[model samples]
Target: MTGRLWGLGVGPGDPELVTLKAYRILRDADVVAWFAATGRESNARRAVAVHLRPGQEELPLIYPVTTETLPAEVSYEGLLAKFYDEAAASIGALLDDGRDVAVLCEGDPLFYGSYMYLHNRLAAYYDHEVVPGVPSMLAGAAVLGTPLVSLNEMLTVLSGVLPADELYRRLVSADAVVIMKLGRNLAKVRDCVERAGLLARAWYVERATMEAQRVLPLADADAARAPYFSLVVIPSATAPGR
Candidate 1:
């Protein structure tokens, strides 16, 4: 019989946050795969490293480029497309050989996880399962001790890379919001939040649940120090049970 493909979410930073199901599948898989930057260690692998037993083959899918900034001749989308295609092929080869392959994702596998690209490329031809894990946005709220959404409130999730005017418009209309992907875009995102009059209500969280975790008011955050894992969260104005 052909081997099954597993997309396992290792949760946000903390190893304790990994779901029992994900751990079990990860431990039993014949091969473990994870995406990482060219030289950096894989956060997803770190989350479940202890659980991996002897004899499991490890597959490291190194990214060709880690940042959006690239040479004029290179296309980010095209490069990534080719990369994922090659990665899918590698995993497919293992499956064809009856080796169950589990792909480790940092957060929920389907929520902006690299595993989604692999799933899209190979799920049609293979038996697979996706195990959801704790997403970073929720982890951010937990660290901030803030309620994310209240009754009848809508929570909007936005990418920090959006244009200034677009970010402002969305922030203005949002009841509760989480803006992710804040690295070099921190200044722009903060500016948009301030323009939308949500800066006072917004909280900035970095590396939530990790040893380097930090939480502060968005208005007071230093844009120059923001990392890719940082995010801005605006909790609901209405308190729960009020």
Candidate 2:
């Protein structure tokens, strides 16, 4: 018998950011799974403490961050494929054994999310469910006091991991843009922001929804910008003297 699977996005870094539906799913989950850096912390797992139960099974998928330090030439696709294969194997084992599972996602499951990789791997073979949660962009936009997009505005969400030339083109045409994966890629992304002439309107948000959440104008931010748990949003309108 195929067991049930839940890919539940828990939002950015705050427990309060989790949706009521996500809360229900978490409380009822028979098994909890989250991505964890090989030997490091799991913020995703920590955020759900209010609803997490003792003795629930925990499946910690090895997140690539803070793990692989190889040269930049490595084919990330190949590396990620290996990780996905391994993750699928683990989830498959549990499902085959008739254990229902909840895969905790940090943000919207399908939005530049890690859960998608696992979901694509596991969902085809089992009964799966995706529980949407508050997105970081929403939480960050509220914290920064900015509406990400207005009527008919073309909004684009990009991965900072893209090549600058490619990213630049996309930014130029977009009325509002959200750049994710801004850790080590911050410099590259900042350059694109400058090239696109959108720095004046860009804002950076990090660890959104948490008490330690941070927001800053891209103009004042430095190379010391926080990486990983961060994002930059650029609105099309000029604030003042453009």
Q: Please report, in order, the local distance difference test score of every candidate based on alpha carbons.
A: 0.90, 0.81
* Per-residue C-alpha lDDT of model 1 across residues 1-242, encoded as one tens digit per residue: 78999999999989899999998898899999999998888999988887889767899999998775898998999999999999999999999999999999998999989999999999999999999999999999888886889889999999998998899988899999999899888989988999988787889999999888988888899657588788988988884421
Candidate with top lDDT is 1
Clashes of each: 0, 2
Per-residue lDDT for 1-242 in model 2, tens only?
86789999898878888889998888887789898777866777877866788787788887574535778888677788898889888888888888888899887888777889888888788999998877887777777775667777777989888999999999988888888888777888888999988898898888888777778887666875465778988865732222
lDDT of 1 at 86: 99
TM-score of each: 0.96, 0.90
Q: Which residue segments of model 2 deviate by more than 4 Å? A: 64-67, 71-76, 238-242
After aligning candidate 1 to the native by TM-score, how far in Å is the CA of 78 from where it should be?
1.1
